[model samples]
Target: MQQLLAPIYSFLQCETPDSWIEEAKKPEQLKGLLIDHCNCELKAAQTAMFLVRKYAIDKQSGQLLLDWAKPYENFVYIKNRDIGVFLSKGSKKNELSGELVARKDFAHSDDLIQKMVRLIKEEFHHFEQVLEIMHSRGIEYQNVRAGRYAKGMMKQVRTHEPATLIDKLIVGAFIEARSCERFAKLAPYLDDELKKFYISLLRSEARHYQDYLKLAQAISVTDIGDRVAHFAAVEAQLICSTDQDFKFHSGAPVLNVTA
Candidate 1:
């Protein structure tokens, strides 16, 4: 596990505060945590799809990306949807109608599409996995308002051409890296099933961060170190600062009532 976390540890400015972990591992927190986690997985996939649609692919290809998320979105958006029905459906909508064609205008468009597509697929599967776990635990799925963690970083994105794209990628990297680090930190405190599941997540989560970073670098003409460091500080402040909301990526809890 240390091998997997070494880079993640070095990448972030600070580890998730022990206070956050203390709140996260509680029996009562498990339901909220898993629910928020399932939401995070879906959001991550949506973010990847957004990046592919906006910065990398043609409109047709972008619609292909949107089509892939429709079933999952329908599941979430429909009022009074059954969790069992979604699980039993078994992700038929996950398969894309066809391969994406990158825009000739961009140099790294194909790489972005390729990497983000793979990420979207994995995140969708992770969403289902969490849903299955929630079902098994008798924890019903419910919509939770998003925490400030991602919005905190996203608010800092630059308002320029490539810089905007690059900054978004860096933000994506921090989010993924933090998720990986948090999973490692919290795994030992969880039950064997969840512990194994979180531990199993480390590899892809780590790769997802690296993939974001690599795409950022590939797309940039100059060094991304400064931009990365800027977000590292921002991300750390978000992690280290006291946050009232308890979520999968929330900071220290002020008052924890099942998040």
Candidate 2:
């Protein structure tokens, strides 16, 4: 376990809490947790799509982005086919070949294409792994509404050129970092299967957050540390504050009295 999560811990700015881990490990909670995680994977991919459309890709490429996300979204939201077949058919291994990565015009497109393409691949793989675990345990999947966490953070993005782009990248860093932190925190409390899975995800996710930061720096001619610090405070507030929703990335619990 230490072997798996050590790199994740070293890469992130924050640590996971014991309480969240405890809650995540409960056998009874596995189904809901996995479902929420599945949702997170799809959302992560969509977020990458938005970045590609807004910054990296041309219109036709933008359409391709939607095309890529649609099938995975279908499997998660609609569950239209067997998990194994769906995974095999829609996987991104073909799209992320070294040649494709080299052909990308990072000057015109930024690192958005290569970075997001790899991220999409990893997120989809994680989605498949979660599905396998659920299937092995006979846990039926279901759709759940998104929590307020990400939306709340994104609401803070400024409306302008490079500032907006820079802010979005900063926000992206926080989201990925927080996800890494949570995965580590939640791992120990989870059962053997999930604990292993979350730990495995940490390294890639840690790199992802770093990738966002690097892109932000590359795009801006000026120092961005101040901007990064600003968003970190904002992101910390959202994570540390009270939230009514229960999700993989939601903030402090707000009494699930209805549940």
Candidate 3:
């Protein structure tokens, strides 16, 4: 776990607050934590799909990507909230195999498509895994309003073509890195099954952040160091500051409730 967290610790400017961990470790908060986590995994997959559809793939291939995500989308959006049905539908991996037509202007469009697609797949699987855990524990999934963390970083995105893309990727790196870090931080306090699952996610989440950073650096003509630092600061503030709501990625707990 130290080996997995070494890079993430070095990447972020601050750690998740002790207050937040104390609040999250409560018995009552476990369901909310898991629900928020399930939502986060879905959001991550959706974001990857958005990046690919917008910048990398052609219209046809973009539609295919949308089609690939339909069931999960249905579960979230259409209120087809049956966990068993959703799980039984399973992943549509075979349907996703085809020649994705890359956009003409983007030089590394293929790279973007390949990496984002793989990321989407992994995130969706993680989503299902979380749902299975929730189902087994009889915790129902519900949509929760997003906290300030992601929006705080996204507000800093540059509004140009590749610049926007590059900045978004950097933001992606921070989100993934933080998630990895929090998973490690919270693992020791969780039950054996959840501890193992959170530990299992460390490798892929670490690799996902690295993949985002590499793609951002490769795509940007200018040095991304300043931008990365800027977003890291923003992300750190979001993690360390006081927050009212308690969600997976929320800042320090402000509520007085105890276990």
Candidate 4:
């Protein structure tokens, strides 16, 4: 467990609990955690689509990606009763094939498509896993409005090509890295099933951060390390500061009068 968690701990600037195993096995705290995670998976798919549209593909493919995300997004962001049952199927049931249509003027485009597609597939799978866990406990899924976390980071993206692209990718890296870090941190505080679930995500989430970094490097002609650091500061502020909403990526909870 220590070896599996080393990267997550290092990234988050924290240590894993020696007692996490016991906390995770608890039956309480299961529903809220899994539901939040299900919402997170859908959001991950949306983030990947944003990348594909803004940087990778032409307009038509971009729209297609958006359309693919629509149903899942509706499941999470809009009211839908079957969401829990729909997602409760299984993530380990099938392998996703990576074949994509060829394109014109497609230098570096296919790579982005491949990466985004794979990410979407994984996010969907994770969404299903979370749903399945919820079903096992008879918890219904509900749509929760997103907090300001990701938008706060995205607002820092530059408004120009390549620069905009680079910043977005760097932002993507931070989001993935933070998600990996938070998963590890929250795992120990969660019940047994959720602890294992979050821990299971660590490796893939770490790799997702590295993948975003590699893509950023591949696309940028300028050194992006400084830009990455700048966004990291912004992202950290967003994560560590106070927030009124209590979604998955929200900061410290603030009471919402609407709630």
Candidate 5:
């Protein structure tokens, strides 16, 4: 675990605040923490699915991606939060037809498709795992609003074609890296089962960050170091600053009150 976190610790500008950990270790915060975590997993899968559909696949294939996500989407949007129903629907295999070709100018579209599709699959599986945990604990799943962490970074995304794509990829890398870092930071404060689960997530999350960085570099026409550093700064500030809400990815807690 130390070996896995070493690079992520050096990559980020700050560690999660001790105050936040203190707040998170309380009993009242467990439900909110797990709820946001479950939502986060689905959102991660949805983000990866969107990238693959928009940049890599054809119209029909895009529809298939939507079909693949429909069950989870229904659970989130329609408030159908039953764990049994959600699991029973199951996930579809993410197979693509030969007709699903890359755009004319983007050279690494195929790579993006391959990597992002795999990411989507794993994220969905994580979503199910979190749901199972919640069910076992008798904690009902609820839709929680997103925190500032991702939106703040996304506000910096460039607006043009490949630049837009590249910026989003870089943002993806930061998000994944931050997730891995926080998982490591918070694991020791949690119960044994939850601690093990969070630690188990580190390997795949690390790989996801590396995959995003590699894709961003491969697709960029110029050096991405400056852009990466810029987003890293934005991510760091979001982590270190005071945040009103105490979420899984939120900053230092402003209030001592539990959720």
Candidate 6:
């Protein structure tokens, strides 16, 4: 595991704060933590789906991606939260219905679709996995408002072509890296089942970060080292600074509500 995480550890400018981990380990916080985690998994899939649809695929193929996400969306946003119906509906399945065609004249289109589709598939599966854990634990899934971690990183995205896309990809990399780091940090404190699940996430999460970094580099005309460093600083601040709400990816807890 250390081998897989070595690069992730070096990539991020800071670790998840000890205060955040302390709040996360509390028994009372498990419900909210897992609920937010379930939401996070779905959001990760949607983000990848959005990237593929917006930048890489055709309109029809993009529609297909949206259609694929609909059932899961209904379950979360529509408050269905029916695991039975979701499985019966086959929304948990990972395979795409048809090949996704790239947009005309875009060199990186195929690569973006390839990486993002794979990411979307895995994320969807992870979402289902988290949902199952929640069900088993009797934790109800609900819409958790997104914390500032992502929005704060996204605020750094440039508004121009290629630069915007590249910045988004860099942000994706940092988010994935932080997820992997937090999973590692939090795993040991969880029970056997949750610990195994969190540890299982490390490999794919690490690869997701690398995938985003490679795509950003491939799409950019120039090196992205400085951009990566810039986001690294921003991401670190978001992690280490005081945050009001405590989600899975939230910053240091402002107060120990559990106390």
TM-score on alpha carbons, each prediction = 0.97, 0.82, 0.96, 0.78, 0.93, 0.95
Which regions of candidate 1 fall more than 4 Å away from where they truly are?
255-259
Give the alpha carbon lDDT tens digit for every residue of 192-243 in model 3. 9999999999999999999999999999888999999999889989999998
What RMSD, rounded to one decimal, does every model reach?
2.3, 3.8, 2.0, 5.0, 2.6, 1.9
Comparing 4 with 6 on TM-score, the higher-scoring candidate is 6
Best lDDT among the predictions, by candidate number: 1
**Which residue pairs in model 1 clash with each other?**
none
Which runs of model 2 end up more than 4 angstroms from their true locations? 1-19, 79-110, 255-259
Give candidate 2's error at residue 252 in angstroms. 2.2
Candidate 3, residue 135: the lDDT equals 92
Query: What are the per-residue Cα lDDT tens digits for candidate 1 across 60-165?
Result: 8888888899989998988888899889987686789988988899988889988999999999999999999999988888877778998899899999989999
Task: Evaluate residue 58 in candidate 3 and report its C-alpha lDDT on the 0 to 100 scale.
Answer: 88
lDDT for 10 in candidate 6 is: 96
lDDT per residue, candidate 2, 69-151, as tens digits? 66677776664557666656644532532232222544737467778788887877777778778777777667778778788
Please tell me which model should have the higher TM-score, number 3 or number 4.
3
Worst 10 residues of 5 by lDDT: 91-100
Candidate 6 achieves a global lDDT of: 0.89
Q: Per-model C-alpha lDDT, please?
A: 0.92, 0.72, 0.90, 0.68, 0.86, 0.89
Q: Give the TM-score of candidate 4.
A: 0.78
Reference-based lDDT, residue 95, model 3: 50
Off by over 4 Å in 6: 88-92, 256-259
Model 4 C-alpha lDDT per residue in residues 177-235, reported as the tens digit of each score: 77777687777766687779888998888888777888888888877877876776676
Instruction: State the lDDT at 10 in candidate 5.
Output: 77
Compose the digit string of candidate 5's lDDT tens values, residues 122-205.
998899899989988998888888788878989999999889999999999988988998888889889999999999999999
